[model samples]
Target: MQLLEERILKDGIVKPGNVLKVDSFLNHQMDIEFINELGKEFKRRFADAPITKILTIEASGIGIACLVAQYFHVPVVFAKKAQSLNLDGEMFTSKVESFTHKKVYDVILSKKFLGPEDHVLLIDDFLANGCALMGLIDIVNKSRATLEGAGIVIEKGFQEGGKKIRDMGVRLESLAIVDSMTDDSLTFRPNN
Candidate 1:
Protein backbone atom coordinates (compact mmCIF):
# COMPACT_ATOMS: atom_id res chain seq x y z
CA MET A 1 0.00 0.00 0.00
CA GLN A 2 3.02 2.29 0.15
CA LEU A 3 2.84 2.68 -3.61
CA LEU A 4 -0.74 3.95 -3.33
CA GLU A 5 0.06 6.22 -0.38
CA GLU A 6 3.02 7.65 -2.31
CA ARG A 7 0.87 8.26 -5.36
CA ILE A 8 -1.65 10.12 -3.26
CA LEU A 9 1.02 12.30 -1.73
CA LYS A 10 2.63 13.06 -5.07
CA ASP A 11 -0.36 13.58 -7.35
CA GLY A 12 -3.49 13.87 -5.25
CA ILE A 13 -5.10 17.24 -4.70
CA VAL A 14 -7.40 18.42 -1.97
CA LYS A 15 -10.55 20.48 -2.40
CA PRO A 16 -12.04 22.84 0.17
CA GLY A 17 -14.93 20.47 0.82
CA ASN A 18 -12.78 17.52 1.98
CA VAL A 19 -12.55 15.80 -1.39
CA LEU A 20 -9.22 14.22 -2.25
CA LYS A 21 -8.80 14.32 -6.00
CA VAL A 22 -7.10 11.12 -7.21
CA ASP A 23 -8.19 11.44 -10.83
CA SER A 24 -4.60 11.47 -12.04
CA PHE A 25 -4.12 7.78 -11.31
CA LEU A 26 -7.47 6.43 -10.24
CA ASN A 27 -10.87 7.57 -11.48
CA HIS A 28 -9.66 9.65 -14.43
CA GLN A 29 -6.20 9.12 -15.91
CA MET A 30 -5.36 5.61 -14.72
CA ASP A 31 -2.08 3.90 -14.04
CA ILE A 32 -2.60 0.25 -14.85
CA GLU A 33 0.50 -0.91 -12.94
CA PHE A 34 -0.60 0.79 -9.77
CA ILE A 35 -4.07 -0.60 -10.28
CA ASN A 36 -2.58 -4.06 -10.43
CA GLU A 37 -0.86 -3.45 -7.16
CA LEU A 38 -4.22 -2.48 -5.76
CA GLY A 39 -5.49 -5.80 -7.07
CA LYS A 40 -2.65 -7.66 -5.38
CA GLU A 41 -3.15 -5.87 -2.09
CA PHE A 42 -6.86 -6.54 -2.07
CA LYS A 43 -6.24 -10.17 -2.81
CA ARG A 44 -3.67 -10.37 -0.03
CA ARG A 45 -5.96 -8.75 2.48
CA PHE A 46 -8.99 -10.86 1.70
CA ALA A 47 -7.21 -14.06 0.82
CA ASP A 48 -8.84 -16.12 3.51
CA ALA A 49 -12.38 -15.29 2.40
CA PRO A 50 -14.23 -17.34 -0.18
CA ILE A 51 -14.78 -14.55 -2.68
CA THR A 52 -17.07 -15.78 -5.44
CA LYS A 53 -17.82 -12.40 -7.05
CA ILE A 54 -16.73 -8.77 -7.09
CA LEU A 55 -19.37 -6.05 -6.87
CA THR A 56 -18.84 -2.38 -7.56
CA ILE A 57 -20.62 0.74 -8.78
CA GLU A 58 -20.36 1.92 -12.37
CA ALA A 59 -17.88 4.38 -13.96
CA SER A 60 -15.12 4.76 -11.36
CA GLY A 61 -15.38 1.34 -9.76
CA ILE A 62 -15.25 -0.51 -13.12
CA GLY A 63 -11.50 -0.26 -13.65
CA ILE A 64 -10.51 -1.09 -10.10
CA ALA A 65 -12.99 -3.93 -9.97
CA CYS A 66 -11.73 -5.37 -13.24
CA LEU A 67 -8.18 -5.33 -11.96
CA VAL A 68 -9.14 -6.88 -8.66
CA ALA A 69 -11.38 -9.41 -10.38
CA GLN A 70 -8.33 -10.68 -12.23
CA TYR A 71 -6.70 -11.49 -8.91
CA PHE A 72 -9.83 -13.23 -7.61
CA HIS A 73 -10.51 -14.92 -10.94
CA VAL A 74 -14.17 -13.98 -10.59
CA PRO A 75 -16.70 -11.90 -12.46
CA VAL A 76 -17.22 -8.21 -11.77
CA VAL A 77 -20.76 -6.85 -11.35
CA PHE A 78 -21.29 -3.12 -11.42
CA ALA A 79 -24.43 -1.32 -10.26
CA LYS A 80 -25.63 1.26 -12.74
CA LYS A 81 -26.17 4.80 -11.49
CA ALA A 82 -28.78 5.59 -14.11
CA GLN A 83 -31.68 3.48 -15.21
CA SER A 84 -30.90 1.91 -18.58
CA LEU A 85 -33.09 0.50 -21.31
CA ASN A 86 -30.71 -2.46 -21.47
CA LEU A 87 -31.83 -3.54 -18.02
CA ASP A 88 -34.10 -6.54 -17.70
CA GLY A 89 -37.06 -7.18 -15.37
CA GLU A 90 -35.30 -8.69 -12.37
CA MET A 91 -33.18 -6.19 -10.39
CA PHE A 92 -32.22 -4.87 -6.97
CA THR A 93 -32.44 -1.13 -6.34
CA SER A 94 -31.21 1.27 -3.67
CA LYS A 95 -30.75 5.00 -3.20
CA VAL A 96 -27.13 6.19 -2.87
CA GLU A 97 -26.14 9.67 -1.77
CA SER A 98 -23.13 10.93 -3.66
CA PHE A 99 -20.69 13.05 -1.73
CA THR A 100 -18.89 14.24 -4.81
CA HIS A 101 -21.83 15.08 -7.08
CA LYS A 102 -23.92 16.29 -4.13
CA LYS A 103 -27.03 14.34 -5.11
CA VAL A 104 -28.71 11.00 -4.71
CA TYR A 105 -28.90 8.29 -7.37
CA ASP A 106 -31.05 5.21 -7.65
CA VAL A 107 -28.45 2.51 -8.20
CA ILE A 108 -29.55 -0.78 -9.70
CA LEU A 109 -28.05 -4.24 -9.97
CA SER A 110 -29.40 -7.11 -12.02
CA LYS A 111 -30.83 -9.96 -9.97
CA LYS A 112 -29.37 -12.44 -12.46
CA PHE A 113 -25.84 -11.50 -11.38
CA LEU A 114 -26.25 -11.86 -7.62
CA GLY A 115 -27.82 -14.74 -5.69
CA PRO A 116 -27.63 -16.79 -2.48
CA GLU A 117 -24.97 -19.02 -4.03
CA ASP A 118 -22.47 -16.18 -4.25
CA HIS A 119 -20.10 -14.58 -1.78
CA VAL A 120 -19.51 -10.94 -2.76
CA LEU A 121 -16.56 -8.66 -2.18
CA LEU A 122 -17.45 -5.02 -2.73
CA ILE A 123 -14.76 -2.79 -4.20
CA ASP A 124 -14.51 0.96 -4.81
CA ASP A 125 -12.02 3.78 -5.29
CA PHE A 126 -13.09 5.80 -2.26
CA LEU A 127 -15.32 5.75 0.80
CA ALA A 128 -16.64 8.93 2.39
CA ASN A 129 -20.14 8.83 3.87
CA GLY A 130 -20.84 5.03 3.68
CA CYS A 131 -23.94 5.73 1.54
CA ALA A 132 -22.54 4.16 -1.64
CA LEU A 133 -21.39 1.01 0.14
CA MET A 134 -24.66 0.85 2.03
CA GLY A 135 -26.59 0.86 -1.22
CA LEU A 136 -24.47 -2.02 -2.49
CA ILE A 137 -24.93 -3.82 0.83
CA ASP A 138 -28.67 -3.38 0.49
CA ILE A 139 -28.60 -5.05 -2.90
CA VAL A 140 -26.50 -7.89 -1.53
CA ASN A 141 -28.92 -8.35 1.31
CA LYS A 142 -31.90 -8.42 -1.03
CA SER A 143 -30.23 -11.02 -3.22
CA ARG A 144 -29.48 -13.16 -0.15
CA ALA A 145 -25.84 -13.34 -1.13
CA THR A 146 -23.31 -13.68 1.67
CA LEU A 147 -21.21 -10.53 2.03
CA GLU A 148 -17.54 -11.56 2.15
CA GLY A 149 -15.94 -8.19 2.72
CA ALA A 150 -15.10 -4.78 1.15
CA GLY A 151 -11.99 -3.44 -0.55
CA ILE A 152 -11.46 0.30 -0.75
CA VAL A 153 -8.52 2.20 -2.24
CA ILE A 154 -8.77 5.39 -0.22
CA GLU A 155 -10.91 6.04 2.83
CA LYS A 156 -11.61 9.36 4.50
CA GLY A 157 -11.09 8.22 8.09
CA PHE A 158 -12.34 11.57 9.30
CA GLN A 159 -15.66 10.60 7.77
CA GLU A 160 -17.95 8.00 9.33
CA GLY A 161 -18.26 5.61 6.35
CA GLY A 162 -15.42 3.24 7.24
CA LYS A 163 -16.37 3.23 10.89
CA LYS A 164 -20.01 2.69 10.06
CA ILE A 165 -19.31 -0.35 7.94
CA ARG A 166 -16.84 -1.78 10.45
CA ASP A 167 -19.39 -1.33 13.21
CA MET A 168 -21.76 -3.57 11.25
CA GLY A 169 -19.19 -6.43 11.48
CA VAL A 170 -18.20 -6.09 7.84
CA ARG A 171 -14.53 -6.78 7.12
CA LEU A 172 -13.67 -3.47 5.43
CA GLU A 173 -10.12 -3.16 4.15
CA SER A 174 -8.97 0.27 3.04
CA LEU A 175 -5.47 0.58 1.53
CA ALA A 176 -4.92 4.13 2.66
CA ILE A 177 -6.92 5.51 5.57
CA VAL A 178 -6.56 9.28 5.37
CA ASP A 179 -7.32 11.16 8.56
CA SER A 180 -7.65 14.63 7.01
CA MET A 181 -6.31 17.02 4.42
CA THR A 182 -5.65 20.75 4.16
CA ASP A 183 -4.64 23.05 1.25
CA ASP A 184 -1.67 20.86 0.26
CA SER A 185 -1.08 18.67 3.24
CA LEU A 186 -2.55 15.30 4.23
CA THR A 187 -2.49 13.28 7.42
CA PHE A 188 -2.85 9.52 7.20
CA ARG A 189 -3.51 6.90 9.85
CA PRO A 190 -0.68 4.63 10.94
CA ASN A 191 -1.19 1.05 9.91
CA ASN A 192 -2.78 -1.03 12.65
Candidate 2:
Protein backbone atom coordinates (compact mmCIF):
# COMPACT_ATOMS: atom_id res chain seq x y z
CA MET A 1 0.00 0.00 0.00
CA GLN A 2 2.93 2.35 0.59
CA LEU A 3 4.05 1.74 -2.98
CA LEU A 4 0.62 2.74 -4.24
CA GLU A 5 0.62 5.86 -2.08
CA GLU A 6 3.97 6.82 -3.52
CA ARG A 7 2.74 6.28 -7.04
CA ILE A 8 -0.31 8.41 -6.33
CA LEU A 9 1.82 11.22 -5.03
CA LYS A 10 4.25 11.05 -7.93
CA ASP A 11 1.85 10.63 -10.84
CA GLY A 12 -1.69 11.42 -9.71
CA ILE A 13 -3.00 14.84 -10.66
CA VAL A 14 -5.66 16.65 -8.72
CA LYS A 15 -8.16 18.29 -10.96
CA PRO A 16 -10.91 20.72 -9.99
CA GLY A 17 -13.92 19.48 -8.05
CA ASN A 18 -12.03 16.92 -5.95
CA VAL A 19 -11.32 14.71 -8.97
CA LEU A 20 -7.91 13.14 -8.69
CA LYS A 21 -6.99 12.33 -12.26
CA VAL A 22 -4.59 9.40 -12.12
CA ASP A 23 -4.34 9.15 -15.89
CA SER A 24 -0.54 9.18 -15.64
CA PHE A 25 -0.25 5.70 -14.16
CA LEU A 26 -3.64 4.34 -13.13
CA ASN A 27 -6.38 5.81 -15.27
CA HIS A 28 -4.57 5.99 -18.61
CA GLN A 29 -1.00 4.80 -19.01
CA MET A 30 -1.04 1.85 -16.64
CA ASP A 31 2.02 0.56 -14.87
CA ILE A 32 1.87 -3.21 -15.24
CA GLU A 33 4.42 -3.78 -12.51
CA PHE A 34 2.44 -1.70 -10.04
CA ILE A 35 -0.77 -3.41 -11.01
CA ASN A 36 0.78 -6.80 -10.39
CA GLU A 37 1.90 -5.64 -6.96
CA LEU A 38 -1.65 -4.60 -6.19
CA GLY A 39 -2.90 -7.96 -7.38
CA LYS A 40 -0.54 -9.69 -5.03
CA GLU A 41 -1.57 -7.50 -2.13
CA PHE A 42 -5.25 -8.17 -2.75
CA LYS A 43 -4.66 -11.90 -2.77
CA ARG A 44 -2.77 -11.64 0.49
CA ARG A 45 -5.47 -9.56 2.15
CA PHE A 46 -8.32 -11.85 1.10
CA ALA A 47 -6.37 -15.07 1.52
CA ASP A 48 -8.90 -16.54 3.91
CA ALA A 49 -11.93 -15.81 1.78
CA PRO A 50 -13.16 -18.37 -0.73
CA ILE A 51 -12.96 -16.22 -3.82
CA THR A 52 -14.67 -18.26 -6.50
CA LYS A 53 -15.08 -15.29 -8.80
CA ILE A 54 -14.04 -11.63 -9.23
CA LEU A 55 -16.67 -9.10 -10.27
CA THR A 56 -16.02 -5.59 -11.60
CA ILE A 57 -17.56 -2.87 -13.65
CA GLU A 58 -16.59 -2.32 -17.27
CA ALA A 59 -13.78 0.01 -18.52
CA SER A 60 -11.33 1.01 -15.80
CA GLY A 61 -12.18 -1.78 -13.38
CA ILE A 62 -11.55 -4.54 -15.96
CA GLY A 63 -7.75 -4.29 -15.98
CA ILE A 64 -7.34 -4.35 -12.22
CA ALA A 65 -9.91 -7.11 -11.88
CA CYS A 66 -8.24 -9.23 -14.53
CA LEU A 67 -4.86 -8.84 -12.88
CA VAL A 68 -6.30 -9.63 -9.46
CA ALA A 69 -8.08 -12.70 -10.81
CA GLN A 70 -4.72 -14.16 -11.74
CA TYR A 71 -3.75 -14.38 -8.08
CA PHE A 72 -7.17 -15.72 -7.06
CA HIS A 73 -7.21 -18.19 -9.97
CA VAL A 74 -10.80 -17.25 -10.61
CA PRO A 75 -12.79 -15.98 -13.55
CA VAL A 76 -13.40 -12.24 -13.66
CA VAL A 77 -16.91 -11.02 -14.31
CA PHE A 78 -17.50 -7.38 -15.20
CA ALA A 79 -20.78 -5.51 -15.23
CA LYS A 80 -21.11 -3.89 -18.63
CA LYS A 81 -21.91 -0.19 -18.65
CA ALA A 82 -23.59 -0.53 -21.98
CA GLN A 83 -25.68 -3.46 -23.21
CA SER A 84 -24.22 -4.57 -26.48
CA LEU A 85 -26.04 -6.25 -29.37
CA ASN A 86 -24.24 -9.50 -28.56
CA LEU A 87 -25.74 -9.44 -25.09
CA ASP A 88 -29.19 -10.87 -24.84
CA GLY A 89 -31.20 -13.35 -22.80
CA GLU A 90 -31.39 -13.22 -19.00
CA MET A 91 -29.33 -10.60 -17.17
CA PHE A 92 -29.18 -8.95 -13.76
CA THR A 93 -29.30 -5.19 -14.15
CA SER A 94 -28.91 -2.26 -11.76
CA LYS A 95 -28.96 1.48 -12.25
CA VAL A 96 -25.72 3.21 -11.26
CA GLU A 97 -24.95 6.90 -11.24
CA SER A 98 -21.38 7.82 -12.05
CA PHE A 99 -20.02 10.76 -10.08
CA THR A 100 -17.14 11.29 -12.48
CA HIS A 101 -19.03 11.21 -15.75
CA LYS A 102 -22.17 12.71 -14.30
CA LYS A 103 -24.33 10.09 -16.01
CA VAL A 104 -26.37 7.04 -15.20
CA TYR A 105 -25.46 3.59 -16.44
CA ASP A 106 -27.60 0.49 -16.50
CA VAL A 107 -24.95 -1.81 -15.21
CA ILE A 108 -25.57 -5.46 -15.93
CA LEU A 109 -24.11 -8.94 -15.74
CA SER A 110 -25.18 -12.11 -17.49
CA LYS A 111 -26.94 -14.63 -15.30
CA LYS A 112 -24.75 -17.41 -16.66
CA PHE A 113 -21.64 -15.96 -15.05
CA LEU A 114 -22.88 -15.95 -11.44
CA GLY A 115 -24.73 -18.50 -9.34
CA PRO A 116 -25.54 -19.69 -5.82
CA GLU A 117 -22.37 -21.64 -5.11
CA ASP A 118 -19.90 -18.89 -5.98
CA HIS A 119 -18.17 -16.42 -3.67
CA VAL A 120 -17.92 -13.05 -5.42
CA LEU A 121 -15.14 -10.49 -4.90
CA LEU A 122 -16.06 -7.15 -6.34
CA ILE A 123 -13.30 -4.94 -7.73
CA ASP A 124 -13.25 -1.39 -9.00
CA ASP A 125 -10.89 1.43 -9.95
CA PHE A 126 -12.40 4.04 -7.64
CA LEU A 127 -14.94 4.30 -4.83
CA ALA A 128 -16.51 7.73 -4.44
CA ASN A 129 -20.25 7.54 -3.83
CA GLY A 130 -20.57 3.71 -3.64
CA CYS A 131 -23.36 3.60 -6.22
CA ALA A 132 -21.44 1.29 -8.54
CA LEU A 133 -20.46 -1.01 -5.71
CA MET A 134 -24.02 -1.22 -4.48
CA GLY A 135 -25.24 -2.04 -7.97
CA LEU A 136 -22.76 -4.89 -8.25
CA ILE A 137 -23.78 -6.14 -4.81
CA ASP A 138 -27.39 -6.12 -5.96
CA ILE A 139 -26.48 -8.28 -8.94
CA VAL A 140 -24.64 -10.71 -6.69
CA ASN A 141 -27.67 -10.94 -4.43
CA LYS A 142 -29.85 -11.69 -7.44
CA SER A 143 -27.46 -14.47 -8.43
CA ARG A 144 -27.77 -15.85 -4.90
CA ALA A 145 -23.99 -15.95 -4.70
CA THR A 146 -22.15 -15.40 -1.48
CA LEU A 147 -20.61 -11.91 -1.41
CA GLU A 148 -17.07 -12.68 -0.33
CA GLY A 149 -15.62 -9.14 -0.28
CA ALA A 150 -14.30 -6.23 -2.37
CA GLY A 151 -10.91 -4.89 -3.45
CA ILE A 152 -10.31 -1.47 -4.92
CA VAL A 153 -7.34 0.30 -6.50
CA ILE A 154 -8.17 3.72 -5.10
CA GLU A 155 -10.84 5.14 -2.85
CA LYS A 156 -11.93 8.72 -2.28
CA GLY A 157 -12.03 8.70 1.50
CA PHE A 158 -13.64 12.13 1.66
CA GLN A 159 -16.63 10.57 -0.06
CA GLU A 160 -19.32 8.46 1.59
CA GLY A 161 -19.36 5.46 -0.73
CA GLY A 162 -16.72 3.40 1.01
CA LYS A 163 -18.26 3.98 4.43
CA LYS A 164 -21.72 2.93 3.23
CA ILE A 165 -20.44 -0.32 1.76
CA ARG A 166 -18.48 -1.08 4.91
CA ASP A 167 -21.60 -0.38 6.98
CA MET A 168 -23.36 -3.04 4.92
CA GLY A 169 -20.93 -5.46 6.60
CA VAL A 170 -18.78 -6.14 3.56
CA ARG A 171 -15.04 -6.45 3.96
CA LEU A 172 -13.67 -3.82 1.55
CA GLU A 173 -10.05 -3.02 0.86
CA SER A 174 -8.59 -0.11 -1.06
CA LEU A 175 -4.95 0.02 -2.03
CA ALA A 176 -4.73 3.79 -1.63
CA ILE A 177 -7.33 5.94 0.07
CA VAL A 178 -7.31 9.65 -0.78
CA ASP A 179 -8.45 11.53 2.29
CA SER A 180 -8.69 14.86 0.49
CA MET A 181 -7.99 16.36 -2.92
CA THR A 182 -7.89 19.95 -4.03
CA ASP A 183 -7.23 21.59 -7.39
CA ASP A 184 -3.49 21.20 -6.93
CA SER A 185 -2.83 19.00 -3.93
CA LEU A 186 -3.91 15.54 -2.78
CA THR A 187 -3.90 13.89 0.62
CA PHE A 188 -4.04 10.19 1.42
CA ARG A 189 -5.17 8.40 4.56
CA PRO A 190 -2.31 6.50 6.12
CA ASN A 191 -3.06 2.78 6.01
CA ASN A 192 -2.03 1.11 9.22
Candidate 3:
Protein backbone atom coordinates (compact mmCIF):
# COMPACT_ATOMS: atom_id res chain seq x y z
CA MET A 1 0.00 0.00 0.00
CA GLN A 2 2.90 2.36 0.71
CA LEU A 3 4.20 1.53 -2.73
CA LEU A 4 0.86 2.58 -4.22
CA GLU A 5 0.74 5.80 -2.22
CA GLU A 6 4.27 6.69 -3.30
CA ARG A 7 3.45 5.92 -6.91
CA ILE A 8 0.37 8.11 -6.75
CA LEU A 9 2.35 11.00 -5.33
CA LYS A 10 4.99 10.65 -8.04
CA ASP A 11 2.82 9.98 -11.07
CA GLY A 12 -0.77 10.89 -10.33
CA ILE A 13 -2.07 14.15 -11.74
CA VAL A 14 -4.60 16.35 -10.04
CA LYS A 15 -7.13 17.74 -12.44
CA PRO A 16 -9.88 20.29 -11.81
CA GLY A 17 -13.28 19.05 -10.52
CA ASN A 18 -11.64 16.91 -7.82
CA VAL A 19 -10.22 14.43 -10.27
CA LEU A 20 -7.02 12.49 -9.68
CA LYS A 21 -5.79 11.05 -12.93
CA VAL A 22 -3.65 7.96 -12.42
CA ASP A 23 -3.57 7.06 -16.10
CA SER A 24 0.17 6.54 -16.08
CA PHE A 25 0.14 3.48 -13.84
CA LEU A 26 -3.12 2.58 -12.16
CA ASN A 27 -5.84 2.75 -14.75
CA HIS A 28 -5.36 3.79 -18.40
CA GLN A 29 -1.84 2.61 -19.16
CA MET A 30 -1.16 0.02 -16.49
CA ASP A 31 2.00 -0.93 -14.66
CA ILE A 32 1.86 -4.73 -14.59
CA GLU A 33 4.36 -5.14 -11.78
CA PHE A 34 2.68 -2.54 -9.63
CA ILE A 35 -0.74 -4.01 -10.34
CA ASN A 36 0.55 -7.42 -9.37
CA GLU A 37 1.78 -5.96 -6.12
CA LEU A 38 -1.72 -4.58 -5.57
CA GLY A 39 -3.20 -7.99 -6.26
CA LYS A 40 -0.92 -9.47 -3.61
CA GLU A 41 -1.92 -6.84 -1.12
CA PHE A 42 -5.61 -7.40 -1.76
CA LYS A 43 -5.18 -11.09 -1.25
CA ARG A 44 -3.37 -10.45 2.00
CA ARG A 45 -6.10 -8.13 3.21
CA PHE A 46 -8.95 -10.56 2.51
CA ALA A 47 -7.05 -13.72 3.35
CA ASP A 48 -9.67 -14.99 5.74
CA ALA A 49 -12.63 -14.55 3.40
CA PRO A 50 -13.84 -17.44 1.24
CA ILE A 51 -13.65 -15.72 -2.08
CA THR A 52 -15.10 -17.88 -4.87
CA LYS A 53 -15.04 -15.25 -7.61
CA ILE A 54 -13.91 -11.65 -8.22
CA LEU A 55 -16.59 -9.30 -9.50
CA THR A 56 -15.85 -5.99 -11.15
CA ILE A 57 -17.31 -3.45 -13.56
CA GLU A 58 -16.00 -3.49 -17.10
CA ALA A 59 -13.36 -1.13 -18.51
CA SER A 60 -10.92 0.06 -15.83
CA GLY A 61 -11.79 -2.50 -13.21
CA ILE A 62 -11.24 -5.54 -15.46
CA GLY A 63 -7.44 -5.43 -15.58
CA ILE A 64 -6.97 -5.04 -11.84
CA ALA A 65 -9.64 -7.63 -11.13
CA CYS A 66 -8.00 -10.17 -13.41
CA LEU A 67 -4.65 -9.78 -11.67
CA VAL A 68 -6.32 -10.02 -8.29
CA ALA A 69 -8.23 -13.11 -9.41
CA GLN A 70 -4.93 -14.79 -10.19
CA TYR A 71 -3.88 -14.40 -6.58
CA PHE A 72 -7.24 -15.67 -5.34
CA HIS A 73 -7.21 -18.51 -7.89
CA VAL A 74 -10.70 -17.43 -8.94
CA PRO A 75 -12.30 -16.38 -12.17
CA VAL A 76 -13.10 -12.72 -12.82
CA VAL A 77 -16.65 -11.71 -13.72
CA PHE A 78 -17.20 -8.18 -14.93
CA ALA A 79 -20.51 -6.43 -15.45
CA LYS A 80 -20.74 -5.11 -18.99
CA LYS A 81 -21.61 -1.46 -19.46
CA ALA A 82 -23.32 -2.18 -22.74
CA GLN A 83 -25.47 -5.13 -23.63
CA SER A 84 -24.04 -7.29 -26.41
CA LEU A 85 -25.50 -9.87 -28.81
CA ASN A 86 -23.28 -12.56 -27.36
CA LEU A 87 -25.05 -12.23 -24.04
CA ASP A 88 -28.33 -14.15 -24.20
CA GLY A 89 -29.57 -15.40 -20.89
CA GLU A 90 -31.06 -14.36 -17.61
CA MET A 91 -28.94 -11.47 -16.30
CA PHE A 92 -28.76 -9.33 -13.26
CA THR A 93 -28.92 -5.62 -14.06
CA SER A 94 -28.29 -2.43 -12.15
CA LYS A 95 -27.89 1.25 -12.92
CA VAL A 96 -24.58 2.87 -12.00
CA GLU A 97 -23.37 6.45 -12.24
CA SER A 98 -19.78 7.10 -13.20
CA PHE A 99 -18.06 9.83 -11.23
CA THR A 100 -15.39 10.36 -13.85
CA HIS A 101 -17.47 9.96 -17.02
CA LYS A 102 -20.40 11.81 -15.48
CA LYS A 103 -22.94 9.40 -16.99
CA VAL A 104 -25.20 6.57 -15.93
CA TYR A 105 -25.02 3.07 -17.35
CA ASP A 106 -27.07 -0.08 -17.07
CA VAL A 107 -24.50 -2.63 -16.00
CA ILE A 108 -25.31 -6.26 -16.64
CA LEU A 109 -23.90 -9.65 -15.71
CA SER A 110 -24.83 -13.20 -16.58
CA LYS A 111 -26.67 -15.13 -13.94
CA LYS A 112 -24.68 -18.27 -14.68
CA PHE A 113 -21.51 -16.80 -13.17
CA LEU A 114 -22.89 -15.97 -9.73
CA GLY A 115 -25.25 -17.63 -7.30
CA PRO A 116 -26.02 -18.31 -3.67
CA GLU A 117 -23.40 -21.02 -3.36
CA ASP A 118 -20.55 -18.65 -4.16
CA HIS A 119 -18.90 -15.87 -2.20
CA VAL A 120 -17.89 -12.78 -4.16
CA LEU A 121 -15.15 -10.20 -3.71
CA LEU A 122 -15.76 -6.99 -5.65
CA ILE A 123 -12.79 -5.14 -7.13
CA ASP A 124 -12.51 -1.74 -8.72
CA ASP A 125 -10.01 0.92 -9.83
CA PHE A 126 -11.47 3.76 -7.76
CA LEU A 127 -14.25 4.63 -5.33
CA ALA A 128 -15.59 8.17 -5.20
CA ASN A 129 -19.38 8.31 -4.74
CA GLY A 130 -20.01 4.55 -4.32
CA CYS A 131 -22.36 4.29 -7.30
CA ALA A 132 -20.44 1.58 -9.16
CA LEU A 133 -19.89 -0.52 -6.07
CA MET A 134 -23.52 -0.17 -5.10
CA GLY A 135 -24.60 -1.37 -8.52
CA LEU A 136 -22.34 -4.40 -8.24
CA ILE A 137 -23.68 -5.07 -4.78
CA ASP A 138 -27.21 -4.92 -6.14
CA ILE A 139 -26.38 -7.55 -8.74
CA VAL A 140 -24.77 -9.76 -6.10
CA ASN A 141 -27.85 -9.47 -3.89
CA LYS A 142 -30.13 -10.29 -6.81
CA SER A 143 -28.13 -13.42 -7.47
CA ARG A 144 -28.18 -14.28 -3.79
CA ALA A 145 -24.39 -14.54 -3.80
CA THR A 146 -22.57 -13.87 -0.57
CA LEU A 147 -20.78 -10.53 -0.63
CA GLU A 148 -17.38 -10.97 1.00
CA GLY A 149 -15.92 -7.48 0.51
CA ALA A 150 -14.56 -4.95 -1.96
CA GLY A 151 -10.95 -4.22 -2.92
CA ILE A 152 -10.36 -0.77 -4.31
CA VAL A 153 -7.12 0.53 -5.82
CA ILE A 154 -7.69 4.13 -4.79
CA GLU A 155 -10.36 5.73 -2.63
CA LYS A 156 -11.00 9.46 -2.30
CA GLY A 157 -11.37 9.74 1.42
CA PHE A 158 -12.88 13.21 1.18
CA GLN A 159 -15.81 11.62 -0.61
CA GLU A 160 -18.69 9.79 1.04
CA GLY A 161 -18.30 6.58 -0.94
CA GLY A 162 -16.19 4.79 1.64
CA LYS A 163 -18.44 5.73 4.50
CA LYS A 164 -21.61 4.76 2.63
CA ILE A 165 -20.25 1.34 1.78
CA ARG A 166 -19.05 0.78 5.32
CA ASP A 167 -22.43 1.91 6.65
CA MET A 168 -24.01 -0.83 4.55
CA GLY A 169 -21.91 -3.31 6.56
CA VAL A 170 -19.81 -4.37 3.65
CA ARG A 171 -16.10 -4.78 4.30
CA LEU A 172 -13.97 -2.46 2.14
CA GLU A 173 -10.24 -2.49 1.55
CA SER A 174 -8.43 0.33 -0.19
CA LEU A 175 -4.78 0.36 -1.17
CA ALA A 176 -4.39 4.14 -1.00
CA ILE A 177 -6.98 6.49 0.42
CA VAL A 178 -6.45 10.16 -0.45
CA ASP A 179 -7.96 12.35 2.23
CA SER A 180 -7.34 15.50 0.23
CA MET A 181 -5.78 16.50 -3.08
CA THR A 182 -4.97 19.74 -4.88
CA ASP A 183 -2.99 20.74 -7.95
CA ASP A 184 0.11 21.21 -5.83
CA SER A 185 -0.26 18.60 -3.11
CA LEU A 186 -2.11 15.45 -2.00
CA THR A 187 -2.70 14.00 1.43
CA PHE A 188 -3.64 10.45 2.32
CA ARG A 189 -5.74 9.26 5.23
CA PRO A 190 -3.62 8.70 8.31
CA ASN A 191 -2.85 5.04 9.18
CA ASN A 192 -3.96 3.78 5.78
* TM-scores of the models, in the order given: 0.98, 0.97, 0.98
Model 3 agreement with the true structure over 130-184: per-residue lDDT tens digits: 9999999999999999999999999999999999999999999988899998899
Once model 1 is optimally superposed onto the true structure by TM-score, how far is the C-alpha of residue 22 displaced, in angstroms? 0.8
lDDT of 2 by residue, 19-57 (tens): 788887776778877898999999999999999999999
Q: After superposition, how far is residue 139 of candidate 1 from its true place, in Å?
A: 0.5
**What is the C-alpha local distance difference test score of candidate 2?**
0.91
Model 1 spans > 4 angstroms off: none
Task: Assess the local accuracy of residue 98 in candidate 2 as a C-alpha lDDT between 0 and 100.
Answer: 88
In angstroms, how far off is 169's CA in candidate 1? Answer: 0.7
Clashes of each: 0, 0, 0
**Where does candidate 2 stray beyond 4 Å?**
none
Q: Score residue 58 of candidate 1 by CA lDDT.
A: 88
- Looking at candidate 3, the ten consecutive residues that score lowest on lDDT are 183-192
lDDT of 1 by residue, 28-73 (tens): 9999998999999999999999999999998899999999999999
RMSD of each: 0.7, 1.0, 0.8
Which residue pairs in model 2 clash with each other? none
lDDT (CA) for every model shown?
A: 0.94, 0.91, 0.94
Off by over 4 Å in 3: none
